[model samples]
Target: MDFAFSEEQEMLRSQARSFVTDRFGAERVAQLAETEAGWDESSWDAMTELGWMGLSIPEEQGGAGFGFLEEAVLFEELGYGLYPGPYFSTVALARRALDGAPEQLKRLASGGSRLTLAWIEGGRAKLLPETGMSTQAQESGDGWTLTGEKHLVPDASAATDVVVVAAGPEGLGLWVARCEDAKIEMDPTMDRTRRLGRIIFDGTPAEQVAGAGDVRSTLERVQMTAYAALALEAVGAGQAAFELAADHVKTREQFGKPIGAYQAVSHQVVDSYIGIELARSLAYWAAWCVAEGDERAPMAAAAAKSFAGEAAVASCERAIQVHGGIGFTYEHPLHRYYKRAQWIDSFDGFGSVQRASVATALLGS
Candidate 1:
């Protein structure tokens, strides 16, 4: 079996890398981090022109007609560049949940609107906190109204619509609420490059996209895809950090010799490399499994997410240590990568949560 990416996938990867490297460099990311929108509108327009938002949707649906593998390739490049935008929340999370809503999907594919999933409730620090969700969707005269508070909504301020999971007459379901109706307050976080918003809905009008019977399956699919994408992104960041640290060690001298000549620095770099490579392999495997709808996809995603998240954080920390005092300064780009790794590591759920899921699958829970 061929484990390498196909020629076409390689081309896609190269193209994405070129665009991200040229347009979304460290300085550009830093500048965007200071903005209220947290992204450049012109650059986002360029990405829409490039058809990145529709990479995984079917051609019939006005997308690139590719699979999750192709999306994985693009996300990896985005992660490497640390592109400060809602691409992950919009494309990876919101788009997946909008499968049943053609009009919303069309808007997303055209980049005419930005949407984000609002599932985290009560400021809970976990993924898919369904049981703890207090959001209620009450049936009204021809529509629904949502009343509750959602915390840590990714890019909520930038989103035009929110895909919210709320309990209704039929039970738990998915609803699309217009952001204009919801009270949104942007919050400051360690990862300045990304934005998180606290959203409050008070009898907000919404459109149901999925009923109770179908909500679980849809959410599961979205969760798996999110895990795969985030894992791949983590791997990309880890690889970049490793490369940077390796280069630093090779040139920086200590005791009249390159620090890389010493066993200690070389060993740390080598360990980081090994971790990144292992994480990459798992990330790719998870993406392929999700794309192919394999039976082991859940396990694969859990394992990939668990390991890759930690590995990426470790790689960033090691890079910082290897760079010595300079790495600790805020001016260094290493801090940005480290912050991103930390953010991704904690997003959805921490490594421990994913590892527990994998353990349950293996041990027969």
Candidate 2:
């Protein structure tokens, strides 16, 4: 099938690329790595001004009136740039949940408000929540109280609203918590580019959005979005990493000849290039599924995440080796991409998770 973008989509992609390139380019990611926070709020505002922050929201609520395809196109650009921000948190993934909340969605799209969802604890969920939760309707004369702690809340530090998940007496569900009424505390995290912290709740308040039946459905969709977004990022990182490797091999000489001329290094560069293209293909297929509402999107998403994650990490490692000692240095740009690649690959699903997901899809059990 032809994967070429629609004319409007291509225009959207071109506009987003120019905007991001001009606003948050490579140097910007390096600068953010120095600071404790991930996003350049001004750049984010620029995205909002470009209507990118509202890419998937309904135009009726002051948004761009687009959906997954638009998001995927923009994400490919984000990956290419290795943008160090919470675009995934605020826009691509959580916006769907916010779409359920009219007021919050409108505020987020039009008012420069930020929204994030806290589902997995520590990082991506390899399993389920430990010491999960059970809901109780505490009888207050006026209302009730909710108490639960969600660890490793992403981009919650500066967020205007957080969508929190909890297991109630009936089943697993989620609710929205405002930082003001709900006890939220943030701190610096390993991935300084993405804001993460632990959220505390002491009779902390919430606004329920989904119940048992649809909660997991919604959550799964969000996870797919996360996988899709991060996978695209890996594609970007992988492409950059491979380029770095190839460029070094072509120029870096040893024994009076370019290292790329040697069979060993030449083969390595070739391998990296192949992996990047194959993973890119899978990722784009997943994006297409998401945009078209294909059922295969979920499994295809898992496959894409698996492939991209593996590729990003492997490509970075190989690229580092291609750069020799320089690649290991703090000053080298390779290290920046390397670290980011490592961190992002570890998100959504690790190697094994994706493998099993692929297996589950391929085998009829």
Per-model lDDT: 0.87, 0.74
- Residue 68, candidate 1: C-alpha displacement in angstroms: 0.6
TM-score of each: 0.97, 0.90
Mind giving the per-residue lDDT tens digits that candidate 2 earns over 69-133? 88888887787777766777777656766656777778777745777777765433532333455
Error of 2 at 71 (Å): 0.6
Local lDDT at 60 for model 1? 71
Collision pairs in model 1: none
Model 1 segments more than 4 A misplaced: 123-126, 130-132
lDDT of 1 by residue, 1-365 (tens): 66889999999899999998899888888888878878886776788888988887777778888889989998888999998878888877888888888887777788888888888876554555455358999999999999999889988887888999888887888899999999999989888877798899999999999888888888888888889989998998888899999999999998999999999899999999999999999999999999899999988998998888899999999999999999999888898888888888887778998888898998977
Clash pairs, candidate 2, are 135-168, 135-169
Best-performing candidate as measured by lDDT: 1
**Superposition TM-score, candidate 1 onto the true structure:** 0.97
